[model samples]
Target: MSDTAREGDAEGSGVSEGASGRTDAHESGAERTAASDESSTDAREPPRLDGWPLVGNTVEFVRDPFGFYDRLESRGDAVRYSVAGDEFCTFFDPDYVEQILVAENERFRKAQILRDSAAGFAEQGLLLTEGEVWRDQRVRIQPAFTPEKIRGYADAMVTYADRLCDNLADGEVVDVGDAMSELTLKILAKSLFDVDVAGRRAVVREATAALNDRGDASGASAFLPDWVPTPKNRRFERAMSDFESMVDDLIAERRTGDESEYDDLLSILLDAEGPDGTTMSEAEVRDQMVTFLFAGHETTSLALTYAWHLLGRNPDELERLRAELDAELGDRRATMADLPDLPYTDRVLKETLRLYPPAYVIFREPTEDVRVGPYHVREGTNLTLPVFEIHRDDRFYDDPDEFRPDRWRDDFESELPDYAYFPFGGGPRHCIGMRFATAELRLVLATMARELAFEPTYDGDPDLTMAATLRPENPLEMRVERR
Candidate 1:
């Protein structure tokens, strides 16, 4: 929305930063190259990493993406590499990240890989749509996530957190990831859909796991054509069938009820009208529901799972969190009102997200060739903003890998560059449910922390996997003790 973002409208122009920290106009890459000495090398092309013939960086990237990214980051802020035959350029600098995601976002669209992977399940939803369709979808859905609506959903969040805590017996050993997934699914269902999905948990969980497995960018089937009947594809199809049936049932049931009485996302989508006085078709509504179901709960559950994992590893921080919770809401349920009084709890979640952001990477593709920082990125280049790498970059945080909530105590976020800590992304296209997720995380963590303490069953770091969301390669088990 800034003026800097609009300068890209002119062809053969580039954007660069001045000494005053404002974007300055510059000649296009070709123009600059032509004007310079013929013997001098062009600064437009980014440094490219050498890889094996044909396969390129596929093996290294598939085997250990984190390490591959580490090596990529070491090369330069703007580094280019190949995965199989596909081209990719990762932007590690926050300024370039800001340009891609916020300032000059209009010049980019969602990555083709993402669209291809998500199309089957999330078709035409806000997640995959572009231009006017996406804008209209966002406009229609915006009211459901307003401040008032989010505040209204807080009671459901706290109630479900309380329910999960009450149900967990003392000395119970549970997979923290699965547990959080179930809890968040319930919270999302009740708060957003105004429906109770307690009986449908198994189907939802299976479907979600299947979706994650199929959509794993690192999986073997990632590059295969979707029509290929690979084992993973078969499983994905079955799961999609079951999930679509469930969605259809939910929609039918909602329609049978007093639609005017409900103010949830389902009702909103059912009744929403666009500026042209159009309503979402049945398929569009289904797409929106599917998008929210996967996105709304998956990221938050991962956040809580990592929060507990981090707390379990750092007992001192856990003690500090429990102390804050005790002082703020002793023997009582946590509500939205208690969030202000529980700063340490908030910081713990913030630090957890910083270390283990569920939406670890944001993918974008340039709609036009544009200059980012000192490099000229060609149109259709797959650009990756590695949020995880940025968060743990030593230049940005001291002891970046350490679990230290106190570091976020005050002025920390204010001092950092805008894109330095974008867990939920940024710009007009930022996650629509950010407010809802933030409030849910705080309330749920507060409620659960008040009644239960987690002891991590594993030692040291858990093996991580890159997927639709960042997940533990193995189940993260934790022993729950009643507080």
Candidate 2:
């Protein structure tokens, strides 16, 4: 997919300029602040929208995040607000997003809100850590997702997808969202651990759902101490405990068996080392395993669910995709080798990811005082990168909301700036499993298109839910007909 970069260097006057958008990159500490003094929105602090006494915009945000942010976008490039006693800056510009994630990444760190919310569930996994430790963990984890390693996982993904379809009959109505979730989880377990998690799928699914719900709640009251046992908090604890036990058992099973027996992500991680020449402890390994289970499966499942939902509504796109699949692999299951020949199918999935990115929004906090555009941001300032808004910004995409796979036909993505459509994110912290997820998504979409025809049970868009990842609020129910 083509991504057109905006003009002007990111380093010019410490401002990253896109086609029309501009954001200030927090350069050398003192110099950046000096430059910000001359900016247009030169205020003592970022623009703040007034709110209630203590809760700030928490209620409105919890009630409807997308709508709240969409409304906030009209106010300014960056809007500061208080939430549950703390302050935050919500950035709508892609240039600002890029600055925080790339050019001046060192000045920022992963938001503590996420770490506190997921701590019990994910522990000290790479997703939560920062600084040298995070860098080391990333180095250790990077090799597992290398191109060669991901290509090795394609067959397992396709095999599991086929297995999920085996029991379905033509014209049978099924919850594609639930099915995709289950299928991806199974694929994750097999692909990562070389184990069948189908037996424990119920436990894993239930636990994950509870955690996501609790996480959403946690975001609203992040200032609350973790020891407080609210009813919801108690339930979340139980779910995390259950998941941890399962992971511990899985690790134990591997320990007793031959580590040399399988070549999976678990094996690689178990043997991976930090830059300091230290191997990961078993507990650390368990944390990473759980992280992969959720991150690996949830996002991919959402992509598949949306792909089918969009295809059901857009027959022309569906036929075009099927045409590519038919022309490439008439009657056989799609393999990694067939990726080059499946360009249209690739575009369909790409478009789906753009419209419905699972990791839709990310939060970061400045390690020190910083400058974002004309605003002077203080240390410990919470910054939110609203990727969803940027992806749909009409400044970059012609019909920002439409599902047009044909838009990706040639150098479309290449024509846009990097942060404009980062479904998997970008820069040093870009998702390590991107290549793996891409391969899995394309193969599953291709395989399903070749095997079944999907018809949506309900018309219009599916209700969206933002858990840890964005997903359909309800089951994406569809009637399936065999090809």
- Model number with the top lDDT: 1
Task: Report, for every candidate in turn, its global Cα lDDT versus the true structure.
Answer: 0.79, 0.75
**C-alpha-based local distance difference test score of model 1:** 0.79
Clashes of each: 0, 10
TM-score (C-alpha) between model 2 and the true structure: 0.90
Best candidate, TM-score? 1
| Candidate 2 lDDT over residue span 1-483, tens digit each | 222112223222111232122332223322543464454345467678888887898887778877888878888889998777778888887766766776666678888777666758777687777777767777677666666777788889999888877878999999998899898998878877888897888778877787677666325544465677766578778877888889999988998998998777787778776666778887888788888888888888888989999999988888888888888999898888898788888788878888898888888998877777666788887788877788788888889899998888667765665577777665556666676787898898888787787899997998776677886777889999787
If scored against the real structure, what TM-score would every candidate get? 0.91, 0.90
RMSD of 1: 6.1
RMSD of each: 6.1, 5.0
Q: Alpha-carbon error at 301 in model 1, in Å?
A: 0.5
Q: Residue 55 of candidate 2: its Cα lDDT?
A: 87
Q: What digit string (tens of lDDT, one per residue) describes model 1 on residues 253-278? A: 99998889998899888998988998
